[model samples]
Target: MPAAALKPKPSNEPLPTQSTAKRPVPLDTPYAPVAKRPLPPGRPREWYVTHNRRLKAMRLAIALLDSGVHQPDQARDETIRSAARLIGVHPPSETTCHMVRALMRYAR
Candidate 1:
């Protein structure tokens, strides 16, 4: 027998793929975080008030849905009112109603 034939056979399996083909990023390049643009002078207060209201309503809806107290229904006004009361929001604003509806969709 020849020497090559006596030797072990080469592997038929392919080599593992790598993710290192991309070039390394330059260390000297500026990489500062994106700066937030300032809001218009008189709009900040109202913007924040509205934003906070929406956030509060979302939180309330999540809590109500998680508690399993209010089952999902397409025409359930009482559920929305209960959720509004749970979050201490009076009059159940449009934002609160929207959040409640969104929560119901997920719950169902």
Candidate 2:
């Protein structure tokens, strides 16, 4: 019978990792300008004027709500034009700008 032999224990040191040995590549080389979809042609003057009006109206509505005016009392669905008028914004509404009211009602 062969004599009983004592085997050595496994090493406690961490195994060599690939990330530490690999060289990193540089990413800042100048490349051809990426093809981007061209922006839509400029809009008519009337379009710009209307867009500005909508923005103004929306802002006015937000301000009115912030000011705590007509808290859930008056008709909240009033057009942006009307709300804008109430909040002193002018030349309102190419389209009927219904108020996009942001009410935060906490659940009971």
- Per TM-score, the best of the predicted structures is 1
Cα lDDT listed for each candidate: 0.60, 0.46
- Worst ten in a row by lDDT for model 2: 99-108
Evaluate model 1: give its lDDT. 0.60
Q: How many residue pairs clash (N, CA or C atoms closer than 3 angstroms) in each of the candidate models, in the order given?
A: 0, 1
TM-score of 2: 0.32
Judge candidate 2 against the unseen true structure and give its global Cα lDDT, from 0 to 1.
0.46
lDDT tens digits by residue: candidate 1, 28-90: 343343345654566668787777676666655665654565655532566667655655556
Q: Report how far residue 85 has shifted in candidate 1, in Å.
A: 2.2
**Residues 62-103, model 2: lDDT tens digits:** 554544554433325454345555555463443423323332
